[model samples]
Structure formats: structure tokens, C-alpha cells
Target: MSIEIIGLDHIQICVPIGEESIARHFYLDLLQFTEIEKPENLKKNGGFWCKAGTISVHIGVEKIEKSKSKRHPAFIVSDIEATRRYFEENNVTIKEEIPIPGVSRFSCFDPFLNRIEFLEYI
Candidate 1:
């Protein structure tokens, strides 16, 4: 028998405990993602949900520690240059990644230092 897999429903990234407001500013205000309602059962756990295009992002509350790694969630954008320009105008430090054939990509850290990547196919 073969195990069947499906598409991603959501992606959860962590923020420090009691810092949901900061996360809200980053994801909702800075990124312009639409806020979504979280179920009552999950509300007590803290954090909130938002939508970026068709992708749902769960900003979860947790104890965060500093780490130097390239771990991130990459979002495929339509215009990588415009996205990069927006990040620059917002004073977000951009980290260039190794070149991938036919792809233009870069990454930046959120308010809490979680790396998020943005890319476009050329």
C-alpha cells in the first residue's frame, strides 16, 4: 500500500510568549495579510491566524531562542524585485541566498527573528 500525501493546509511560526501583538504588526500590518479567526479551543493557546493569498499562517506563541540557521517558509511571489524593494523601504535586512536556476529569491527575518523567504520564478 502507498501512503497518500496532500497539500499544505497552513504553516505555523513561533513568537515569544505574550508577544502576539508584535507578531500581528508584522504579519498583518507589515505584510498586509488578512486576519483570520482561530477556533475557541485553540484560542487559549495564544497567537492568531492570518491569510497570505491562499496560504494560512498560524502565528503560535512559544519560548524562542536565537539560532543561526536558514530554516524558513518560502512564499512564491509574482514579482521578486518589487517585494525586495518593499522590504528595503521597510528597513528589513535582506539576506541573499545561493542562486537557484530559474529562481530569484531572498530572505529576511521577522520581528522575532524567524527567517522568511520570498521567491519568484524567472
Candidate 2:
């Protein structure tokens, strides 16, 4: 493999069609990600973009059936407990309790049942 790879540009997670508002509520309002406008040509396809640190998170639209899975995007946070408390207060189920050495973490499902992990280094 001679190809050189650069760092991540974005990670796209899919939600059902017409659920962009729900995604907005969770990603923007709850998680505090800033929404970026989708390009004009791409607007008709639905979905939107968000800024998360140096990377972009793309919420794509597709017809989907909800299911639980371990695969998820783990976001680094400054305060794990405070983030956890926010999710708890919002009624999002905190599904895991195991802590990695030197780090604190928890997993939860977004409104679309997309598993998301939030962690912080201790």
C-alpha cells in the first residue's frame, strides 16, 4: 500500500428520511454541535452537516429501521460526568458503566437509535 492517508475529514451517520429536524435537536441542541449549511446541490438529497472540533459530522438521510448495535462514534469531551448528567436529565439511557484506565466513558443511543460514545481522559 503506497497510498498515504491523511486524518479524518468526517464521519457520516444515517437517519431515516425527513428526520433531519430530530437529528438537529440531538446534535445541535443537546450535543451543542454547530450546524453548517449543506451545499445547494446537496440540499435536495436531504441531511445536513455539523462541526465537531476539527472534524465534520454528516447526518445523512436514508430509509432505515432502528436497531441497537455497538458500532458508534466516540466523541472526546472535556467533562464526562457533566455530559453524562446532561444526557441523563434529557432521559437518554446511559447503557454502559465500564471505565477504561485513565479515562471515563459512557454509551447512549441518539433519538435515531444511533449509538454514540462520550468519553474524557482523566
Candidate 3:
């Protein structure tokens, strides 16, 4: 049988230990994503999950000191300019805009320094 790949089920973003609260503030308070309960089996391991539009976003705990900057998740938003302004007002570092033929977009680092991209279709 051929492989039939469907849509994304989830994306796991990693953060160092003891930074879950900081991550929550960025994801929940700033980004406005709703917090969701992690599975009981996984709760003991730390970190949590969040509902981002239709897909699940899992924030996993890592023991490392620094998070990678290049690898990231790009989210489709309604107004990228407004989103950029919000990030700026919140003091989050905004990276350069990535120009795609029919999209307006920019990238930023989360509280833990993990990269996140926001974009809107033209």
C-alpha cells in the first residue's frame, strides 16, 4: 500500500526546564493560544499542550540551556503587520521579514529564544 499522508497532528516546541511559565506567557497571554491539558501519562514529564487554531501545539521540556534559532513553526495569521506591532510592543525581538511571492511574513523569537514565524497571504 502507498503511504497516504494527512495533515499535521501537532508540532512540539521545546524549551528549557523551569521556563514553562515563561513559555506559557508568550503562547497564552501574548499569542492568545488556549492552554490544553497534557495527557496524564505525559504530565509528570513537565510542559503542556495548547490549541492553536485547528492543530495541537505541544511544548516539551528540554534540559538544554539554549534553544535552536533556525528551526521553527510558521503560523498563518490574518494581519501580519498588526501581529508584528504586537510583538514589538511586547518587547519581543522581531527578525527580518521573509518575502514569499504571495505572502507577507516575519519571524520572531519566543521568550526562550525559539524562532516563530507569522505570515499572511496576499
Clashes of each: 0, 0, 0
The per-residue C-alpha lDDT of model 1 at residue 116 equals: 94
**CA shift of 26, model 2, Å:** 0.7
Residue 17 of model 2, lDDT score: 98
Best by lDDT: 1
TM-score to native of every candidate shown = 0.94, 0.89, 0.91
Question: After superposing candidate 3, which stretches have Cα over 4 Å from the reference?
Answer: none
Q: Pairs clashing in candidate 3?
A: none
By lDDT rank, best first, the candidates go: 1, 2, 3
Tens-place lDDT per residue, model 3, 31-98, is 88899988799998999899977968899998876755687888999898898888889898888874
Comparing 1 and 3 on TM-score, the stronger one? 1
On TM-score, the leading prediction is 1
Global CA lDDT of candidate 1, please?
0.91
How do all the candidates rank in terms of TM-score, highest first? Answer: 1, 3, 2
Which pairs clash in the backbone of model 1?
none
Per-residue lDDT of model 2, residues 9-92, tens digit only: 888899999989999999999888999998999988999999977968999999988987666788889998898899899998
